[model samples]
Target: MNIFKRTGKMALGSRLRMLTAKFTDDASSIYNLYNIDMQPKWFPVFYVLSERDDVTITEIAVEIGHSQPSVSKIVREMAAKGLVIEKKDAADGRRNVVQLSAAGKAIIVKIQDQYQDVNDAVEELSAEANHDLWKAIEEWEFLLEQKSLFQRVRERRKQRESGFVEIVPYEAKYQSAFRELNVEWISTYFKMEEADYKSLDHADSYILDRGGHILVALYRGEPVGVCALIKMDDPDCDFELAKMAVSPKAQGQNIGWLLGNAAIEKARSLGAKSLYLESNTILKPAISLYHKLGFKKVTGRPTPYERANFQMELKLG
Candidate 1:
């Protein structure tokens, strides 16, 4: 019924639950269509167990981003189904380790093609949305471990209710703020490449003088986020969305979204035809934001940074 289209963010939890149920039911149907004899919910734990010879329940929980108790329950079901074997860890008798059984291995081997087909289908579905749901879900799970959903909600509510976030243009004194903000996100997900250092350390020489623009988000008059629209010398007068970050303290404040919208407007004001960005799939939130701003995936050219695997661009005019 397109619950997402109907409810939007007003009923996020309910919409997500409906979508999850739909996906799970569709996956089960696909397995049955392929003559596979496993439920869709078992794929995550089974896939993790298949990758390693032996792993503890806690380890599986960490790897699959599931709660220990939830993983243990799945393990018990799989063990009874003869799909997995659980044994006491030799080093820690209190800990129980698990592994895929011979039967499970045989079944997986038989359904390998089906797995590929499912993944390919998922990719096609993701293309329709212009973003990968699997990647988004995984990254969200990673973030939930770092900060709970309730905590993020409280922080966002406080920020919105207080109206402390303000978007402003880059100033000379904000050079250090720019560098620090960019470094925080890069160091968290990737190392700062030489290109990053060159541009960030000298914004005037590498960006401003080259007809680029930078925007900073201030929280209570302190620079808390930054994003840049870097001008390119190509015939199209392109702008690369680059060096964007928000301070951890100012996260959940919609600063990134504010900075991104500002950059897009700046690019248009500069007569840029399109905007490009390079990023890793692990940075799912960032990629999702780009998609939300009308960016679409494109084949990336050779990149100077090691972490860039996904490339996307937005048309301005």
Candidate 2:
């Protein structure tokens, strides 16, 4: 039984690695046949050097699609074998550049016939397989760069998990969840202050009964995210969009985003003119999310929370 064959696409990386091992072994034998003194892994660096002179590791990395550290390590290995030389860039005293040594140039000259033979062999192999592998690889890389595999999987995962998310108005049964969710996030980032406990402890009184609203997000009928449109006593803003929290497990599913937009619409329904929020600068993603929701930074207002160094307001018409 072949596990890779059975697993199919799930084993794509393993299958590619297996093929690489076979190809590398064949490359080693081919080098031996031509009396070459270089390893297959070092060929990329040597090929770049053969075409150019006085290049930095950054240039080599960009040319070959490899990382700077990997290129530097390969350069060091080649230097140890006396096949390459490293020199300080005359134009830039602080930086170093690499070029092929005399022996390296000799190796390229020796491999000219070998390169021709290898090219012919590859052409024949591609013809026999009826597949242009080089072109296919380029197309595959372009598509992956446009949208990474992680992003693709994340979208699919969200689609699958969203079936479990539900948004509902506040209920007495959800009091503990309302407090716990806020406490979990606040304790993780900053200290729990008097304002947090005041609203979280008795949300119905501190927020709801005072002409405010609360929205609860239920994942599989359990509270996973919650936010409040706390009515304000001030004249400028009608509501404070605060106490927004999402469970760690429910993150990446846009649960927080859904709740935020819901709260905004809910505030509008209640005839709100503007919305205000206070958050810490350390919560960069939260700040970014607020900005995306049309919230702009505001100043000159005193905050009640100890962690409120950043404030934003959104106008609702």
Candidate 3:
């Protein structure tokens, strides 16, 4: 029987349980194949104690989300293995302080290196699949949290206080406003070239003609920011993120994030598996924002566009 089928009665809980089971099974299989008994659970406890050598056993338990008795049992086992050392807490004589032994510290480093193999296997999966998996996991977590009474009330209050604006296709009427916002915000923010500022209209036109769409952030009937997705002709290439700019007046209001997220959503809607953008190092905040949004650096020169002074890409599913 499929492992999932064994847990089918519980539906959502079953799926989660099955996932954990699969992970454990896979890990055990790998360990057996390598003729090793590297108990994965102990690694986290070792890691935490290694970082804070003087931490109390209770602190280790709390950090690793284990009960005191469970942690104590593991600690005693590890101590017997000479992987950890415990001492009476100096300030609180009743408490036992936990620290990694030399063996434990060395094993943690080895565990990290072996874990890189797991990371490599994960990275081999298609970017779209990884993105979808993470997105589904996040949605599940959010839905689970929403089931809590306190979370439901908190979400409702947040929605009531924070006004949300829908993303709409950019129109010609908003083009000038977008341009003004770009020049006012981006140029000043990044110290962009004057020629770069002058070339946006033509570049934007080129993108729009190529099955691309721009969304302007509107508040009170005024365009506050702009973001766009330009379709890539190359099937192997991702859609390009273009014309992302927020009004200077709206800098701290997360307008840039809204615009960037809208561009990502639009790119996904267009059947794009990834999104790429051109940016400069001078735009540190923008670069930081892109990194925060999961963009990674690529080893190549920017595309032959005036605004593509630098480049970054984010996988989308």
Candidate 4:
């Protein structure tokens, strides 16, 4: 039976429960396929509770964003399984505090080791697949959070007619507009210097000389956004994607994502094995886009580059 069909009336909480049920099944099936006994859900809850054994049931529910009754039931089940024990709060007799039993702790340790085996099997399948799966899950979480904010914005805004937006490769005629958009976006968000902004045009020329491409987003013949793909000079390095900028006035319309997708496609066409980008935390929207695009965070930072304030990379097929 469809879990959502049964719980469709309860709104967000029910939807969350449905999602949990779906993924819980997936995890259990994956473990069974590998002849493993444990699934993934218990660890997160166990780890959280184990850290603060005296934490109240209400606190656990809040920390995990589950209903109080739901958490209570789960804790009761865990207690029955000898995985957790609930005791009266020392300070508040009416309140119950949860702690992991020794058996529970042992199970978590074994699960942690088994998780490495699962990760290894996943990595062997394809790095890109693993990255894409993780990204899709994260995007689902983000959209759920944004639903309320989107509804609030819709309540106050007039519905405008949709208009066409064109995307074109960067050219001399659109150079000034392209530069202006980059300058405005970087300056406002990153506080980058004028010289650093000016250097981007030069860097574009350098990239073009090495078989890389740059693209611009146009709105009715006016350039409003930009992104670029540059083949790496070092044989050891993969193609570098850079200079992604969307006009502040043109944001919230999904233009940045469109530009990014174009860049990734272009890189793939160029026979690149990996695509990398440089960005900063100040540009939160851009960072979010990178994450949505399946780019994972890495430890290293970018070298000195005209458009870069930091760096992230994604492996491609």
> Residue by residue across 87-125, what tens digits does model 3's lDDT show?
888888988788888877776656665578777876676
lDDT of 2 by residue, 1-317 (tens): 28976898867778879889999999999999999988999999999999999999999999999999999999999999999999999999999999999999898889999999999999999999878989998998999999987888898888888778888999999999999999999999999999888999988789989999899999989899999999889999999999999989889888887888989999888889999999989999999999989999999788888889999999997
In model 3, the runs with Cα more than 4 Å from the true position are 1-164, 189-199, 305-309
In the order shown, the candidates' Cα RMSDs to the true structure are 15.5, 2.8, 17.0, 16.0
What would the per-residue lDDT of candidate 4 be over residues 51-109, giving only the tens digit for each residue? Answer: 67777778888898788887787877778888888889888899878888888777655
Shift of residue 314 alpha carbon in model 1, Å = 0.3
Worst 10 residues of 3 by lDDT: 157-166
For model 4 the local lDDT of residue 116 reads: 85
Reference-based TM-score of each model = 0.52, 0.86, 0.46, 0.48
Off by over 4 Å in 1: 1-162
- In candidate 4, which residue pairs get closer than 3 Å at backbone N, Cα or C atoms, i.e. clash? none
Candidate 2 residue-pair clash tally: 0
lDDT of 4 at 218: 72
Global CA lDDT of candidate 1, please?
0.86
Top candidate (lDDT): 2
Better of 2 and 3 by lDDT: 2
Give residue 265's lDDT in candidate 2 (0 to 100).
90
Global Cα lDDT for candidate 2: 0.92
